[model samples]
Structures are given as C-alpha cells and as structure tokens.
Target: MAVNKLVYYIIPLIVLGLIAWWQFGFGGLFENLKGGVKGVIEMAPNVSIGAEEELATEPTIPREHEEAINNLVETIEKMVTSPKKNCFLNYKLLGKNYGTNSGMPSLGEGGTTISFQLKGDKTEMLIAGGAGGKQEVTRLRKEIAGFKPCVIAGSNEITKNFFNRYLGQGQILGDNYKPVSIINIFYDTDGDNGNAIRVPEFGNEPVNDEGDNFEDEGWLFKAEDGSICFFPTNKVMSADDDGLVYGNINQINTKVGVVGSGLDYCYTWTE
Candidate 1:
C-alpha cells in the first residue's frame, strides 16, 4: 500500500516538471523572464517624454508685423459692425428680406398693426368679387407656399388680380358689413405690374409697449419656389404724407394669399 502511494505522488511530480519544461525553456527560464521585465521597466521612462520634460518657448512677432496685425483686427471689427442705420433710409433686412411693407406706419405716438379681413373661405371671396379677381386665389396660394426674401417672381400679376378684386380700404370690414376704415387716409392706385418701390422710412421710435404697441401689420405671400415679401399697405400707394413712397411691388395681398391694395391712412409721428 505504501509503495503504491509513493508511485502515484512521483508520477504527478514528473508530469508537472515536464509541463513546466515544455512551457518554459530548460533551466534559466524564470531568470530570463525576470531580466525581460526589469529591462521593460528600465526602458519605459526613457521612451516616454512626459509633460514635465517638455520644453516651451514664447513666440515673438516682429514690430511691423505686429502693427499690421493690429490694423487688420481693427478693420475686421469695423466690418463686423453695420453702417449706422437711418430709419429714414433703406435698410438691408437680415430676415428673409421679403421686402413687404408693414401695414403700420412708424408712429411714435401710436403703435400700429395690420388686420386682414378674412373671407372665412373661398365662397365669400366669390360673393364679394362678383367675378373680379376671385380666380387669383388659386395662383396666389401657390405663390404663398414658396416665400423667400427679395424674390420678385409672379407677385406683380398676383398683386394686380388681387387689387382688381378688392378696393384699398384701410381696415378690413369686420363681421359686420359696415365700412370700417383707418383713422388716417388710405391710398388709391392703378394696377400692379413689375413695379418697385423704395419702402418708406420712418424714424424708429421706441414704443412704450405696455401692451397696444405694434410696428406694422402686413401680408406675406410665398411661392412654392420659396419666394415672398411683405406688403404693409392695403393698396399700392404712390405717396406718403412725407412724400416717400415704395412702389407697388410691395403691394402685398388682400385677405386672400396677399393683402389689400395700397398703404393705409397712417401718419408716422414721433412720440
């Protein structure tokens, strides 16, 4: 029994020694491994240059070059700032620049807005025009779907058709049929075709804006091609009280896709 137990233990020892010899080399395997690990540890710091070991130097620009840079910076600063806007002059709108007139004139004394006389539906337009420009809505709605700034496409003809249908009354007739008008005088003009107007400029006066303050009311007609502008006036007006006028191109539409005919009776007074 003792001899059998010794044989079993000796067999396991022999198998383990063979496995170790096969995995490692014959004798100095552990010593070689220890030397390799030590070599890697010793070489690591030399291979990697850390942040503390980095060398940095300040850059120095020549005097003339530095001056030139400063001047260029100043020029850039000025370019970034817009020329002071004069309310009495034309403005390059940053928005879509639809260039439609705002129905309200800039009146510091009173805030203004545009109100459309809604037909509720196309049937009302047919009843109102009695064969005037009701068909214009078909084309007009198509135009309105594609609105963008400064695009003068089919707007002129549409404007004409719209004006042919509706007269340039200041305020839209309310639910009542009574002729409601603006407190000021409105304008009357001929038809619309390829007309252009430099939009009227009023001094920008800050509004109290406690509530009832609006700069203007206008209409926007966009085309499927993303073309549109603002029409502030109900009708195409040739003149303002200040004798300034934006041509009929700015004539938005009536209650349809566009607005009414011309400028409403608004006096732009400063507060």
Candidate 2:
C-alpha cells in the first residue's frame, strides 16, 4: 500500500513539472502575454488634451453697439404698438443687378416696400415688390413676421473679400467694422419731407472706377410698397443708374395707405 501511494505521488509531481516547463519554454509564453497587453493598451481611447482642439465661439457685439440696437428696438416697438396715420420711413431705392432694362417696365424701376401692420393679435410685416415690380419674395405676413431690424458686427470672409477687392492689396479691413450709428432719422409729424439716408460710413464716399463705391451689404429691411432700407454701412449706387437710385423709397411706415406719407420717426445718427 505504501509503495503504491509513493508511485502515485511521484507520477503527479513529474506531470506538474513538465506542464510548467512547457508553458515557460524559451520565454515564448511570457512574450505572448506581453504582446496581448500591448495590443489592449493600443486599442484604448486617448485621454490626453492639448491646445490643438478646435472650438466654436460667437463674436461679441460692443457695449455701445448693444445699447444702440436696444434703442432702435425700443423705437420700433413704440412705432408698431400705437398705430399712426400718414407716417413713413423712406430709404434709397434699389434695383436688380440684371443688365439694362431689368426693372419696372413702366417706370424702369425695381423697388420694394416693407410695411408693419397690426394683424389680429400680432404685428405683421408685409413686403409687396421685387424685381420687375412684382411681389415675388413675400406673399404672406408670416414669411417676414417678427422681422425686426438688427445690427450685425464682426469681420467675416465676405467682408474681408469685399475690402480686399475694393481697398486694394495691402489695405486690410480690420475686424472692428461695426454698423451701430444711426444714419438718418425722420419724424412723421410733417407729411412733405422725403428722407435722404446716407450710408453711415461708405455712403458719403463716391464710388471708384472699378464699380466699387459704397458697398451695400444689401437691403437691411425691404418693404411691400416697393420700398427698401439699408444697414447703416450699405449704400445704393449703380454704374447703370447714373449713380442715383431712382424711384426707390426706403419707407418704413404704418399702413396709412397714402402715397406720400412722411416718416413719423426717422433714423437719426447717434455717432
């Protein structure tokens, strides 16, 4: 019995030693384990951070500019809240960039009119004209509902390209291009005055030979009676129109329905 037990124990010990030697032979098993660990580490997500990360940030409007916009908003609120008669805000007229003979067929003018009217419970903004004297853009008030004049600051690629093309090489348009100041103001107490809106900075300057005078950022606000208005920096001058935008009245008005209603509250230059 004792001999049989010793044989059994010796056989088990020899089997255990052979298994250990096979597992650790020439360090190959350990190398395989190390490679598996390395692969797992390589598959892990990276958590390191640096300055190369990209972020989206909105440009900031200056404090004074903010104040100006607030004041303008307040003025608009007052005008729209209490309806008036024989009131209009006029802006220089504009036409399409289409070749000659591309405006009103009868008057040879392309204009727009933007009106603020009280409809039901909400104030409605209505536009009534477009290229060729047709109301092609806006047919319903909701298309332009809640459309209030706003100010936009900050230099962008479009602004840069415009300046580069007009200001010429080495003439850089800085990031500080702000359109905050009031260009003109009209009060509708009188019914005979036609407002002349000067483009705050660029309007007063005559256009150059390269068809770049004052760059109009386009219509800041267009109305339904074929009237249009510009942002303070935008101007209306064309090489084809003899430098005068004719038949274009930048009119912002209540629906007095009068042909020549004067401005009740016109824009006045702040700075």
Candidate 3:
C-alpha cells in the first residue's frame, strides 16, 4: 500500500517536470517541481495584462476653454429669454478673405446657413437648411463637442492667448435695437466660379495643427466645422441696415482639411 501511494504522488510530479523542462528549460525543472504545477504557473508571465486596460483615452479640454463656452452659453440664454417675441438670428459662413477685393463689392457663393427663432424660454435653431431642423441651443452645444485654445502651428507658443491678434472692428448691437432680418446676396460677378464661400466639412471634428486648438469667445455653430469664432452680435437681435459679422480667419487656429482659418461671415438685414 505504501509503494502504490508513493507512485501515485510521483507520477504527477514526473509529468509536470517533463512539461516544465520541454517548455522552459531543464535548468529550473527540479526547483519548479518542488511546489507542483502551481509554482510553474506563477513563474510564467501573464501576457494578457496588456489587454486589461485601454491603450489610449480621449483628450481633455482645458478648464479655461470650458469657462469660455459657459460665458457664451449665458449670452445665448439671455437672447432666448429676450422680451422680443419675434426675435430672429441668422448665421452665415463666408470665405476667409472676404471683402478684401478692391474694385466693386466682391460677391461669392454662400455656404452653411443657420437660422434661429425665439420660442418662449429657449431659441430653436435650424442647421444646414435640412428639413428636420429646429433643435434647441442645448442640443447645439452637445454637437460642438468642446473647445481648445488657439495655438500657432510649429511654434513654441502652443498655449498662447487666442484674442491677442487684430480682428477688424464693428459696432456691438445695442439692446435698444433688435435685428429684423440679415440677408446675404451673392453674385458670380466674374463668372470664374471661384467667388462662392467655401463650405466647411460638417459633422467631422476639426483636425487642428500641432499648435492649433480653440476658444469659446465666439458663437458655436452646431456644425461650424469644429471651430469657435466671435459671436456676431452683443444683443440677441440686430436692426442695423448692415448687420454683418465677419469671422476672423487669422484669429482661429489652423484646420487640417478645411479652407479658410475659421468660420465665414454672418450677414444679417441686407436684402
């Protein structure tokens, strides 16, 4: 009975010793078999550990950028709750270097049109001239994703201030004056077919340059090609004969695949 019991215990150890020798090496086989199969397993590395966690995570937006958006949100909220029941705001995207042409008022094809009409507490926005339009400002924020600070590409000042550059001056829309309508007329003037305002690639996150990022100082379009430029107006509405808000292309960061530096011009009240 003792001999049989010894053989049974020895058989498993012998098999384990052979496996260890074949898989690893004959050098540690004896030492490994001292603690049975458990020792060999513990010695073996766990190759599955790499898959336990994700290789990368999404980038986080800076806190200052977040604050900028909040400020703009506050401005929009006030507009929605304005006393004017027939409030209307239209946002248009024009080319980067618009109005720089010397002779005659250069006209180009309009691109990316967004309109908003106040409804009680919140304003309903229409994006891209689609049939299924009319979403609230809150929904627009979700689509914008987030904002990043403006950074010049291939430069040391990656975190430089965004509003330091020169952007042309314009009168802020006064509270006493409310916007009725803003219309942009485009003419193919030269017939070269090149004057049309280039439309930004909507629904895709903007691929900024190495130093490129964003700021929340401007009005965030639902799909403004992932950029944040200046808000066209101070008050919710504008009643000026020439209510035009031009986006400073130089002020915005470089976009990888989009034309112009930032958003185009938003024209209002010129039929």
What is the RMSD of candidate 1?
A: 26.8
* Weakest lDDT window of 10 consecutive positions for candidate 2: 100-109
Residues 1-271, candidate 1: write the lDDT tens digits: 9999999999999997778778887766677666676566456633323341221212232332233223322322222232321111111222422222433222111111111122222101101011221212121111111112321112233333333433343332221111111111111122332112222122221111011211122332222222222233223233221111234423322222223323222112231
TM-score of each: 0.18, 0.24, 0.22
Compute the lDDT of residue 65 as modeled in candidate 1.
25
lDDT of 2 by residue, 5-86 (tens): 9999999998976785698874875687666765554465232223211111112323322333333344444333333421
Error of 2 at 250 (Å): 12
Better of 1 and 2 by lDDT: 2
Best by lDDT: 2
The alpha-carbon root-mean-square deviation between model 3 and the true structure, to one decimal in Å, is: 19.9
Cα lDDT tens digits, model 3, 1-271, are 9999999999999997778789868657656555564444345523123332221221232332233334444444433333332122222222222243211122222222233333433334332211122222222332221321111111112111222222333342222111211111122233233212211221121111101111112332221122222222111112111111123332332331234433332222331
Number of clashes found in candidate 1 = 35
Best TM-score goes to which candidate? Answer: 2
The C-alpha stretches of model 2 lying farther than 4 A from their native spots are 1-58, 85-145, 148-262, 266-271
Cα-based lDDT at residue 61, candidate 3: 28
Q: Which of the two candidates, 2 or 3, achieves a greater lDDT against the reference?
A: 2
